[model samples]
Every structure is written in structure tokens, then in C-alpha cells.
Target: SLIVKAISRLGPVARTGGVRGPHGVRSEGAFLSPLLALLLLLLLNWLHPHPKALKCYKTDSEASNLTLEGCSPDKISCVLHFRIDKSTGARHRGLSNCWNLNDKCGIADCLYTPHSRIEDHGSCCCRTDGCNLMENLRLVTSPPTATTMPSKGGSSQGNRNSTSKSSSNDSGSEGGLFAKGGSDQAASVLLFSLAPVLAICVTVVLGFFLYTRHRERRKSRSESVGLASYPVDNHPFPVGHLSSHIRLKERLATGKFGCVYIGEDAETDQRVAVKVFPPQERGSWLVEQELYSLPEMSHPNILCFIGADQCGQGPDLRLWLVTEYHPLGSAHDYLAGHTVSWIQLLDLAESLSRGLAFLHESSSEKPAIAHRDIKSRNVLIRSDLSCCIADLGLAKKFFQGESIGDVHPQVGTRRYMSPEVLEGAMSFYKDSFLRVDVYSLGLVLWEMLTRCTDAYGAEGVPAYRLPFEAETGSSNPSLSQMQAAVVIERRRPEFPAECQSHQGLSYLRETICCCWDHVPEARLTAACVAERCKALRRLPVSVAAEEARRRQQEEQLADQQAPAVDLQLPQAAVINEASAAASAEELRPLREAEDAV
Candidate 1:
């Protein structure tokens, strides 16, 4: 305060009662406040400043002309990307373009200089307008690859900003401009007083950082091989790792999510199936990722998952779930092309049931998973005619005692929905939910049988048709139409009389009936179905009468268990969040919407 008054008096003074200066002009004391404000304005401008539009030179390789292009509204810098081939040492240059602030460029708001060098990619960015000219853009210390791809650039920016903040805070906090003597003395006393505390804090922070870095290094080394380390984060998996390794080929199939593309790993050259999901189906992609990440989820009967990733950004953002490729395509298409023998039918059924059983049956400490949508189209056939389950977008998991999450009860294909699901009387209990999948599995099994030439050869094996499509006489039956046919009339897929003559087909027909039974509680579990298929497979068409008799005995024992049984019939099991089951009358209004699923 004393220094301020002395300075104001020495410079020029103007108060309501102050004397005049030599020139007879009176200066007011209010001017001192304005002087202080001007200093604050300068300091503020140095600390926080808004960026302006930056212009860069866009080199047109084809036209051989240079045009000035302004940075996009979301971008804050101009970048020059560069790449080099390792074998030939050939340098490739990407045209200068607008870059985002959080991009791979580690420096901005300065002259163009190579700042971020990652792998083979190196780029420099300048926030200054017209600074990214064709002449100004030149490789200083770049490797070969470019585009300012994000890696260490964000951390570099943080370090730079932190340095600036420290300097600004140190200079602005002390009264260096107004009272240098007291400010210096006070700063020295405070520094001496807090030196021990500051030292201890710095030591603790440094030690924690080093320990974290060591743990990360060990974790990265352990997970360098497989996807065991990959988490179910919403963001893309190993952003740079997948892009560099997988080389995508032509599209294989298209579905509700996106398209399936055939890709090969660059390192192994092994073929992979890349199932892509659109931006709108991101939730489905995440669900599939979580399911795949479960412990011991991998099985020979189940599709082998490699990893999941994201495609481009903005409007082109697409999610990718990679798995082992099967060239023969889905069972629906395979059965349409060629008729299957009785042995082939057994193989497909056995593998399909085993896969489903693995999914529905919990392993290790993980919860059971129910694939709500089970159909021939979602089953892929290998070269050996063995099948594997795929497309788990609508799958749900059941924990032992924990509360279940919200599931869209009306989701899954209507053609495959069980009677309980069709009437919306199904509870959210673990066993009841598994029963729903079993019902759909029965429908799929019937469809596969209808295509087997040996089962109904006498009646001139019928054309490939869905479960109720033959009964309803329509490819896509409405919910009202299905309920009227399957629920009201209690009709199932008809098995030709000739099928009864084949011992194997006869047992399978019986199994199908048990699977799609009207009573959800009486439906056969996936494990039971798998066991039945295995036993039936032993008694082929030429098997002896004794073998057939033994198979029948095994089937009877499978149903009546001595220990814990597969079917746990819970009468009126209302397990969903304090809410009663939606009755058939309640779901009557949603017939159209349910048909769309």
C-alpha cells in the first residue's frame, strides 16, 4: 500500500483535493487503478488465448497446383505428413492438411518443426496461419510414416502446457511489479518453510509414477500374444495394432449389424472373419465384446474370437469383431445348396448343441449366457460339416445372485421365439431364459432335419423351409399368424412318416418335440440335447437292433437324472425386477413390433 501511494504521487497525482502539476494539469488517483488493470490484461493474454483460423497449403498431386486451404472449424493446426519405406528407403509425403489439436502433432502455436515421431510416422503442426506453406513444409527428422497419428503427442502437449502454467503462476502470484523487495523476501521465507513438504510430495509422486510404469511394462509383455489382455472398453481395441496387422479383403455377407469381410493377419497370413457393425449398432458390438471377453468362452464348437476394433470416425465409424473364417458360409446357405446325409445331420446337430450348451452352461466363475436369437442363419458350418454358433448380438448373461440388467424382452427373431417368449409370459430367471434358447434350438434342429435327404427321402424330401413356414404356408408369418398356428393350434414342424423308419431320425424327431414343447419347463436343456445327439449318432441307419435298444435306454436315463437335473421348473417364476411377466393379452398390442424383431 505505501509503495503504491509513493509511486502514484511520484508519477502524476490527481485527487479531489490534490495540487496541480507543473503544466497545471491535474491527474486523478483513479488512473492508478487503470494502470494496474492494464498489467492484468497483459498477463491474462499471456495465460489464456483463443485460437484463430489457420491457413495451410494443400498440394494437389494430380493437378500440380497449390491452393491455400483453411483449417477446419474443429481443427486447430496445419500438418505435413510423411512416410518412408524401410526396404527401399523411399520417402512418401502426404499433402499438407488441417489437423486437430489432440492429433499426433505434439507442438502447435509455433513455427513448423518436426515434433512427434512415432514408429515410422512423423509430422509437425503449426497453429500460425500461412505457416504450413509448401516451401515451409519439409522433413527435418521424420522417419517415413506420417499423418500425425496419435501416440505420445497428447502427453507432449500436457508437458508443454504444464510448463507454461508453472511459469505464469510463479510470475503472476508474487507482487514483483509493484513491491519487489517485500515480494522477494516473502517468497524466500515461504520457500524455506514449505521445502521439506514439497520435497516429500515430489518423492512420493515420482515413486508412484515409476511403480506404475513398471507394472504396465510387465502387463504389456504378458499380453503381447493373444487377446487375453484386451478389455471391453467402448473405444476401439489396440487402435494401431489391428489396422497394421489385418488386411481386409472383399465383403463376405451383410446383416442387421453391418458386413462380414474376409481378412488375413499380416504376420501369420491366416484367414480371419471380420464382422462389422455400423455406428448405430455400437451397443451390440460392445455386448458381443463383453461376452467374448469372458473367461473360457472359447470352445471348438463356438466361433473363435480374435479381437474387436473400430473402423474410421464420424459418419464412417464402424465396429469390427474378428474371428476365425469359415469359407462354407452359414448352415442356411449350405443346406440350400446341397442336401445333407443322416451322418452330416448328426454332426451338425451334435456340434451345434455342444456350442449352445457351452454358452448356456457356466464355466469357471463366469455366469451363463443365453443366445436369444438361435437360427440356421446364425450357425456356420465348417469343412467337416460340424457347426459353430455365431452372432451373439442379442445374447444375455445370468449371474448367480446378482440383479440382472435390462434386456429388450422383444428382441430376437420371431420365427425362433419360444411359446413363452411369444406370449411374453417368460420370466427373467436363469433357467427360464435358458429354456427360451432351447426352444429356438429345437426349431433350428427341425429345419436342419427337413433338409436331410435321408430322413424324408420317401416323400421326396421337401424344400428348405423355416420351422412354422411350412405349417403356416408363409415364409414370414405375422405374430398373430404364428400365435394362431403354433400357440393356438399347438402345431410344430411336421415330420414325414418316412422319417420314423430311420432309427436315428426317429429319435431326433422325438428330441425336437422335447425341445420345442408347449411347456417351457418341460423343454430339453442344451446339455441334454447334446447328450442325446451323441447317443443317437452311435446308432446309424445300419446299426444293430441291440445298439438301437441301448440308445433308447440311454435317452430314457438322460431325462430321469439321479443327481441334479438340467430342468429346474419354477412355477410362475417372476424374476424380473419386481415386475410380473407380460401376459399374452398385454403383448397383443405389440404384435407388429414383435414381428419386426
Candidate 2:
């Protein structure tokens, strides 16, 4: 029928393009020959007898009455299986034919329903025809006993003998298959048995972690209670519960981390600077606290730490850092309104350098520290005109044999960045980090000098300007602008020529120049700069004394060079000589009278 349809579809094409022989004889049989052959082949397939397929009683579920069904031509073997639901005590039996005669036969777990758990399932498959029809399909809990039946083509007595031998061989194969299934069951059992143990171990570890965290929190609370009960002394300041004694006053300054406020200790009534950090700034608060809590950290040139505390909960939580307050505020603020005398400038510079040197010094209990953000705003001016370094949030502490390379990269104000730091080529050594601080300190010194009345002469002090503000035209310059000015252009803060006229100011200029040198190794150490400042402090007194002696020598030399007038004494000179001679004679008489008596 398909061949007839193909010929009918090509009837028009065959007629329009009919095949012609060399002698012009039209031949239509050539195209029809292939179609006729295909039709004959299909007819022969329908007439020929097919090989016999397996006959089996097949059903997916247990049926009260089952009918034998013929298997497909490809299926040569039969299979029968039964499953029992452990939860419901229901049973299911199924029979099907397989395409291959070597289909494996064994009782094992089987998946039946989609998205359903596998209950107590057991399935058995076999290769023989009608094997599913045997009585062996009965529900026997133990491994199914292999059974054999006679083939249709053999004699009854001969088939019986062959069935006996095949049954024996199948029994051994079934035993080995059951043995593997037993091993698999043992492995599953073992996994389930250890589940509780693994769960217990994980729970214990998590509980221990929680317990340790709880204990640390409890200890912190206890310390806070102790601090509130007693007056703050030399011990480490507790970092909790501050509202009880500390009263916050006016806000002083605000920064990226938090705000600084003026506060007072209720019991002592001593004013202090309270730095309030938000919850997100907890890390910075802790870092500053650790820096201040170091042993022997208290110094005249360093900010004095009082105590720290926390208040509120969650997003509303605020961390408080209390320290000694200076009414004069930061050096930057002070320099904005007032110019310092030469002596005052020297004093501020020396104190700042001393604080930095102390921070860099290491002790048995404390490590050397590098104040990464060393700027005028971070240096506070005390009422006594001295300066103390503050705001150690970016400070890096180095223990013995520790490398400075572990610090975060390029953190600080852009305007005061060093050449190496600006170019991002900073070396990761102790000295290299310290030099970065020195370069920033040099810019701060320039800030102080620019506002020094003595350095600028009668024109008085220049308006307070940040380092490189003139070149960048912005107080807060971008990183690229700073890099261009400090690294590419090699520009630094300007030094007035008038400052060089004074010996002390000239030495200060040299010190500042050395500190801000492009070469990190060439910069002066904090200690060295401090010593130079001390020398400048004493310079004025020594310079004045030397001037006095120089003037005295000049006057005596002028007297000696004066021309002499001999043998021509004035009347006033002669009269003075006679009166001196008379007075001497009377004194000589009085002396002789006294000796005789």
C-alpha cells in the first residue's frame, strides 16, 4: 500500500520527465520497476511466519484473576516480581517480558510509583519462556528458589533430566547474587547506625563554640560592673556600661567612623573627649581601644585614655571611647585662628615628634606601632600649647619579628600621603612604614610653620593651608591629584625664605625637608626629628648670649683703635689728677696712724 502511494505521488513527475532510450523509444517501466520490487518485499514479509515469543501472565498490580498474554516478537524472556509495603502491610505482584534472554534474575529493591518512597520491595527476573508462570512466584521471604520447567520442543523425560541440572546451576548463581545484596544491605545499615554519632559530634562542637562566646561576653560584663563600682585606675579600662558616670556634652567633630563629643565624668567631674562610634564602626573602635590599652602607653605627648563602653542594642548600639579632653581642640583648628610664636612652634613640633617616637618604640609588653594616618587633624593641642597624637584607628602594631607588610594598603588622608605611598610602591618593612609616618609628620610640620609668626617675618603668618593645597587648589584633593603633585611632579610644601633668616627656623626647615624626602630610607626617624626640635628650643637662649659677647668684643676693639693724644692734657684732666693725689695722701696718713695704734 505504501509503494502504491509513492507511485501515485510521483505520477505527474514521471509523465513530465519521461525517460527516453538512445533510439527515441519512450520507456516508462524503468521508474516503475523500483516501486514494484519494494511492494513484493513488503508482501513477502507479511506472508512469512515470525519466530515464537515468550507467553507470560503480566500485570503491574496484584490481580484476582490473571490471563496469559503473548510477549512482543522482540521479547524472548519473562519476569515476575512482588513487593510488600512495610508501613501498610499491602502486597503487589507484577509479571512482564524482557527483550534479552540473559535478563538478570534476583530479589532486590524496586521503584514503582513516581515520587513515592520505595517500600519493602522485592523483584525477580528470569530468562526462560513462561518462567513467570511457575509456582516459584509465591511470596517466600527468603531468596527465591530457582526452578526449571521443560522446553516445548523436548521429550518429557529428557526435559525433566535437563531441568534438574539447570535448576542446580541456577541455585548456586542465585546464592552468589543474594550474597552481594546482603553486603549492600549491611553497608546501608551501617550508614544509618552512624548518623546519630555524627549528629552528636556536630552538636557538641557548635555548643562548645556558643559556650565559649557566652563566657567571654559574661567576663566582659563582669569587668564593666567592676569598673562602674570602683574608680578607674591604672588597670585596663572596661569596654561596657558608660552612661552611668559619663555624661556626653556638645559634639566636637564628626568623621567617617563616628562623632567626637565633649563629655564629663560624673563622679570626678573631669572633662573628657567622648568618641561615639556606630555599630558598623565596632572594628575601628576595638582597634583604637587596643592601641590605648597597651602597657605604659600613657605619655604626656599621647592622648590619655580613660575608659570605653557600649550602650543600647542592635542598630541603635553605640560604642563610646572616653579620653582626656583638651579645650584647645586639634592642632588644625588652633592654627586656623592663631599664629604660634617661634618658641610655641618648637614646643608643638617637639611634643608631636615625641608622641610619634613613643608610639614607634617597642617594650616587653607592648609592640611598636605605626600611626598610618598622621595629620594635623589627628594631633590635639593641649591648653599648655603642647600637642599629643590621637586617633589611632589606622595604626598598625608590630610584634617582635613581625613584618609590617601585613597592614592594609594605602590608608590615610590623600593630601599628606608620602611619595612611595602616593605611587603605591611602598616597601613592607618596619622602617618603610615608619618613614610613611615621618613624611606625613613633615607635612604637619609645614602646616605649623606656615602659621608661625616668626617664620614669615613682619608680614606675619600666612593663612593656614594644608600641605599641597596651593598646587591642588582643593583642601581635599583626589588621590590622582596628590600622586601627580607629590610623585610625578615631585612637589612639596613651600618653605618661605624669611624662615631661613632665623637659625632655629632654618634648622627646622632642614628637618622637615629630610622627613619628607622622596626616598623612604632617607627620611629622618621620629626620634631624630624630636631631638632636632629640642635643639631648636635651646637655640634662642644660646644665640642671644653669643650676640651679647660679640657686641662687648666689638666695643673693646673700637676703643683700642682710637688715636692717642700725648703731653697735652686738658685742664679738667689735670684737676682730676691733683684731687686724686690729695685724696690718696690723706688715705695713706690714716693707714699709717691705724698701723701705729
Candidate 3:
């Protein structure tokens, strides 16, 4: 029938171009013969051996009715075997499964014996799907007598042994498929019937994929600006192996998107940090993956991404990102109840600035990405106490040749927000976004500098306080409160005047002030801050403090001796001199230390 349909469909096309043979016969038959043969070969290829195993219910007196798949095709009967408890004489629940057929088994209904202790001889066997259902428990409980069993008579034996006999010839035949010869024709017809639908579905899916890919390429080319397009990772991860391999030991932190946990690798037993996000936080998860997948993104000062996974499902879905773990936790926790030396402060500042600088860098494979949320809590520390920037959840990417236009200006910690961000007047330009990060860096540097041991001279480092905590008097300030403090009042985090004693602290304090400058244009870049940190470490701070003090006294004496009042700014000069004298007084201990050196 398939061949006839194929020939009839091709008949119209062949007839349109048909030529007559010498004896009034069409030469189209010549082409039709080869087409028919090809169709036959295709048909043969389509016929696959159907899965011949029968599915049967299985239970050992359990509440579950387990469906057994891929049982041996020869095991055509479903068996229910139950025994009376030896002492109680009470019939227990039956054990039901696909039957194991043997030579002594009945052609249709076979009884082995009235009763047997070991072989479950009284069990009931029937050739039907789920025939072992508990509704038929009475069949197993009451065994048939020997007289009621079908005897293997000569006629029955002869009929079963006959080579030419068909299964249909026996009235009690189970209708089980025995061999490939029995079902080849049926299997071939079934496959050929369903082939076109399967082929169309596959072709439609493949063509849709190709069309979407081509359209994306054309759109990207149209937006080209002499720079390579950003590379996107497919981001397939080992979801199956996530829960099986990594054992989460303790929860480290929790936030808007998800919770972080300390997980240990089952194989290597190495500690790893696992950030698990809920299904709704997939956007943040993708952002983290994209930032980490960028070229040259792996730095000593950035959190390392090991892998990602989809653990559990539905309401319990968790988007997990695994990374190398550090024991010191975050800068907030590290600086709590402790103080750091000037050198340790420099180390933390430099490494953090370097990481932020790299994040704002544009490469062939990546656009400039800004970590919009920069805070002491988001900054993690390694064993050496150097800082690495973490948590790219709120990060934004700036692809080349695109207008940033307007943005969601109100972001990041309220205290760390820049004047422009707090006022909601920030420009949606690339440099503007990066400067926000630098401003937050400044606040964080101030947070760390507040804990610097030598900054306050004899007073020691004051207990750690977040930026603007002194004025606001709250760890978490409201948006309006911050806007008033940072934008309207132009108030920044204050430092003790005595911090000017150490030259390095003075330089660092200057850098922090520059970072959080009221004017965004005046703020230093992350790279510049990193360089300043390195220079502070190299400078002889005590000697510099001494030279600054000597220069201050000389200026004071020179101003006292030289003629004044040339300009009407004498009061301004007097005020500046008075502040200089205060700085001079503040640096006396630093000068003594320099002298001692």
C-alpha cells in the first residue's frame, strides 16, 4: 500500500515530464522503478524492533503497586503467590510479579500441585496485564484440587508440539508475541505510518533553531561598532552531580536573591563556597555566570567561579554557583571586633581596587561590567587578609556602541551611594556608573581605615563603624536620610583629625575623600586608587610626617615675618594657618617616631 501511494504521488510529476516510448508506453516507468526500490529500502530502515517486554504490577504486601518495566518477553503470565502463615494459618498478602515460565507451565491454565512448602506451588497464574491485583487474593488463598487441574493429554500435547500450528488455533492462547518472525510485518506498518509526523516535528525544530541563530547574527552585525561582539556562554553545568558530590556543611550568609553555604567536595574533601539562589533569582545567577565566564576575569582579588547547577525543582529549585572558599569570610566580619595595621589596610585597599578596576575593564570577549553593589559585606578576604570583590548580583554590563540613556539610579548601600545616585540625578553613561562603584570603594576604604591601628595615634583604632554611622546613628539608614546626608548636606564619613599623624594614613584619607567627592567628575578612577595605595606602601610615612610638620612651622613663621594684608583674604589665610597649626600639633608623635627612626 505504501509503495502504491508513493507511486501514485510521483505519477503526476513524472507524467508532466513524461516521454512516450517506441510502442506507446511511457518511459516514466523506468524512473519509477528505481524510486520504488529506494522507497522499499527506506521502509526497511524505518522498521525497528519494538520493545516487547510486558509491564506488570509488583508488590510484597506493600501499599505501593510498583509497575515493573522491561520484564522478559517470554514471561507472559502475571503471578500472585501467597502463603498461609505457618503458625497463624492466616493468609498473608501475596507477592505479585511477572511470572517465570517453565516447561511444566500450562498452555493456558496450569496447576502445579495442591500444596508445596518451598516453590509456592499453590500460587495463581494468569496471562493478562496486572492480573495479580489484590482483588484476586482469593485465587491464591484457595488452591485448586488435583482433579480440577488440566492434565497434559495426548491431544493437547500433540497440538502444542505441532510445527505448523498457529497461536490462534488454541482457544486458550495467551496472545503473546514469541519471536521477530511473528511481529515484523506489524512493526514495519506501524513505524511507516508514524514516520512522517516524527520527521516533520524534527525538521520544524531544527529549522526554527537555525533561523533564530541567523537572525541573531544579522542583528549583531548591524549593531557592530568596530569592536567584537560580546561572547555569551551556553552555561551548561553538572546539575545531576551537584547534590550528589558537594555536601553543604553550614550556611554562610543570606540576602535578597539567596543564601550562601559552605560546601565540601565529597571526592576531594576541599572546602567550597556555594551560593544558592531561588528560581526567581535566575537573572542574578546568569549575571554571575557571565561575569566569571569573561576572559581575564579570573584575578587574585576576585571570587573564583567553579561551576553552577540547578538543584531540586519547582518550589524548591535552587540555582547554585560553586566557588573557591575562604575562611576569613567577608571584610565586615573580618574587621569586626579587631583592628588592622596600616600595611594591612593598604593590602586590602590595593587588592580590592585592582579587582574593581578589572571589573570595569572592557575586553574582546566581555563588555565593561560594573559591580553596582559595593560594600564591606560584599568584599571577601583570603587567608592573607587581602580583599577580593564578590557578589555580582546587581552588576550591569556596558556593551560598546550602545546608548545608556536613563538608569535606575537609586542602588547599592544607602551610606555608600554617591551624591548623584542618592539624588537620583545620575547620568546613564559608562564612566558615570563606574564612578558610583569608586564612590562605594571610598566608603568601604573609610570603613576599613576606621579600624586602622596607627591612624588615631594613642587612642587606638575605634570600634568598627559603617560609613556615616556617626551622623545618621543607624547601621541601616533610610534612603531619604542618606539623600539628605550625602546630597543636600554634602556630608561624608568623618575621620578623627589625629589620623593626620601618619603620612600614609593622611594619604589614604585624602584618597578616600577624593573617591566620595560631591562632584562625580572629581572622583578618582579605581585604577588610580589602586596606584595610590601602592605608592602609600612605598613612601616613608614617618619621615614624610616629619617633613610635613617642619614645612608647616616654616610656613607659619614665614607668614608671621613677611608682610600680610596685601589681599582681603587675610581671614581665610589666618583660618588656614590655624588649621595647619592643629595638623602640626597632631603630627608631633609622628615626628618623634621619625626622630626615633
- TM-score for each prediction? 0.52, 0.54, 0.53
Best by TM-score: 2
Q: Write the per-residue lDDT of candidate 1 for residues 44-71, one digit (tens) a residue.
A: 3344333455687666644245578776
Clashing residue pairs, candidate 2?
A: none
lDDT of each: 0.66, 0.68, 0.68
Q: Write the per-residue lDDT of candidate 2 for residues 1-597, one digit (tens) a residue.
A: 433343343335433434788888756455444444434333333443233555766654343456677875434456554556787866566444342222234223121221123345544445455556435454434432333322222375664454445434654443222112223223323333444554565456556766887999976864344334334455333445566778888999998789999987677777879999998887788788877877778889999888888878888988888888899999999999899877788889999999999999999988989899999999999989999999999999988986555566689988888988878898787778888999999999999988876565435566778889899998789999998889999998888775544455666888899999999889889998887787555455443233334434434544553343222235335644554454344335433532442
Ordering by TM-score: 2, 3, 1
Query: How big is the positional error of residue 188 in model 1, measured in Å on the Cα after superposition?
Result: 48
RMSD of 2: 26.1
Query: Which digits, one per residue and each the tens of the lDDT, describe model 3 over residues 280-360?
Result: 888788778667767767788899777776679789887788877899999999999678876788899999999999889
Misplaced by over 4 Å in model 1 are: 1-240, 266-268, 541-597
Model 1: lDDT to the true structure:
0.66
TM-score of 2: 0.54
Task: Name the 10 consecutive residues with the lowest summed lDDT in model 1.
Answer: 571-580
